[model samples]
Target: MSASELVFPPGATRRDWMADGILAVSLSLVVIAVPFVWLGGTQEPDPRVVGVSLAMLLPLTLRRHAPLLMLALVSVAGALHLVLLDVPSPSLIAVPIVAYSVARWVPGHASRSVLVIGTFASLLGPMRWFENTTSGNPSVDVLSWGACLGAVLTPYAIGRRAREVAESRGAEVRIAEERYRLLLAEREQQGRLAEASARAVIARELHDIVAHSLSVMIVQAEGGRAAAARNPDVAAEALDTIAETGREALHEMRRIVGVLRAGPEAGERPTYAPTPTLEDIPELVARTSDRARLVVHGEPGNVPPALALTIYRVVQEALTNFLKHAGASAHATVSLSYGPQHITIDVQDDGEGVEDPTDGGGNGLRGMYERVASMGGSLRAGPRTSSPRFRVLAPLPAPPPSPPPTHRRS
Candidate 1:
């Protein structure tokens, strides 16, 4: 039998073997001694008879270890006893016990063969008397044969069915464990991906908020220096603008940092200042007006923080690009339109747009594209009818329903 078919139950220790040996020996002794006591000691038992009876039980001790060999040994001993004594003895009963043991422990074809052979040996043992005697009780012989067969086959059949049930349960447990392992692995992968995506988003927001604010600060600083020598009023105004823009930028930075530092168990709270939306575009455009024309159109309202921040960053990045690449006097237009289902923002400049920004080691357009795409939006930046255009279109998610108002009787 293959190792797969054999299942050794847990806690089958040396003590268990000792216990089984004691039980088998006791049962055999009972089978051998009961008949002699019943016959009232009138018939003197032969030494060979006692020796054969004892020998028959030797196989029972090793039944579990070597079932097939033990059954064969017991059968041979029973047949030899029948031929020598010419009478069935209590030792012959051991044949069915050994046969059942073999059938219960052995696997596949070996177990079936043992059961069949054991049944034949049991029934035929008493039948040998019919061939020898002129007056033999057929009813007693049949009953004895039936009882022997039942004793052997019943336990073997129960053990075989139990083994099959145990094997099936083991297989189900293994399959469940495998599925659990796969699910755990998949969850870990998703967590890593989510972490990576959060970091990328934080980086983009920091770049837009800090970079754009710093650019305005630099320009204002330069203007303040140039005007400090001529007009004190102009320099003071420029310095005031710098201070306000710096404070706003710092506030936004704190929010992003707080979100990054917070743990997973942190409750929902305001992590940062509310994100800038379309309404803030007028102020954003006013800051960089010296070199670019900023245009705003559409009735603006409050939007989700994430979408609002996206709009603010898109415009900020577009203006930064114009200032860096286009000449100081280059013309640019910033347009924002809010519709029922989506919001569109377009930044166009008459300056020369590079066919490939990567060749120049510039990531402005690439960053802009990534930012838009992450929000389930689209961004297109290339040459238009006569100038270069960068446009963003983002679908607005449905607004959550308002909670019902509480009422009291007047």
Candidate 2:
């Protein structure tokens, strides 16, 4: 379907065959001319000489196109010329070249077999010629035959090995390219998933900030309107509270926007306002308490702002849930314990717990779980053993060392 899928039949190009034909024809002409020009006319040129040369040169044109047939034709012509009349010629050069072409270009097992057989046959031609010669020099004959065989087989062996090496290297390159492509694809997928997670987190923070603030504003406005006709001072205080709450909400929104704008280039330095911590717990309780009382225990210690913020939010959300679901007579107890390695916060209400409080498919509890997990801590929220309870426990990361103290004595 694609260009990569298209397959080409293996063989030499037309250019290759044409080049070999030209070389073979030129060499034959030179070899045939040597006897006439250089040998001083001692032996007359045979009429079959032209015919034998043509026969040898013609078959080479198709050496790559039809290698087996071409090798057979050249070998038969050379052998015939040798047996009938001894002729000194270079026509035998075509035999080995054709053999090498067949081995290098032909794709199938059958072609390779043909190439091997033809190579052997080509080698035998010189051996036969040397053996039948009247010359008694055995060493010369052996060396000449060996040289001929070596010339014929060497190119074939070298070409075959080159093709094998090229094929192996090509395969390795393809595998490496494929692996790189897959790794890039995986990284892109992970990046998309991370972006989606970040957007979801931002959405939850926006919802909590807007929903909680708007609810409080509505309640304060109604209270002020009702009290205005009866007590001007009380209505003025309610108005002031409303304004303060609105400003706090705006500040938080601005902080959220700033955080969202901070990109990767913002570096590892902390940005936005310091997150709300346990010190802000009294304010959180007072906001939703109405007629309820707030009590806290434990010596204050430095805690990671991220974990502290999580604690504050958990308590806030728990109180909000209690306000909405619990009766008006319901009251809550907020407790905090700072340990050597862990900080624990509990928001317990003396009212009817949910039919199934554990069923927290909403993003509120899920967000809390994610925040706690990010700090390498855990959270559990359900009914207390004795009374209704919503508990959150988080392990605080070790504090960074304080700067050296400076003191001046009188």
Top-scoring candidate (TM-score)? 1
For each candidate, what TM-score against the reference? 0.71, 0.70
Candidate 2 segments exceeding 4 Å error: 1-88, 106-111, 127-132, 135-145, 218-243, 258-271, 291-294, 353-361, 385-410
Steric overlap count per candidate: 0, 0
lDDT of 1 by residue, 28-88 (tens): 6786677778889777667777777877876776666666666777777777776777676
lDDT of 1 at 188: 97
Per-residue lDDT tens digits of candidate 2, residues 199-225?
877876775566556655665677789
Worst 10 residues of 1 by lDDT: 353-362
For all the candidates, what are their Cα RMSDs to the real structure? 5.3, 6.1
Model 2: how far is 353 from its true place, Å? 5.3
- What's the CA error at residue 322 for candidate 1, in Å? 3.4
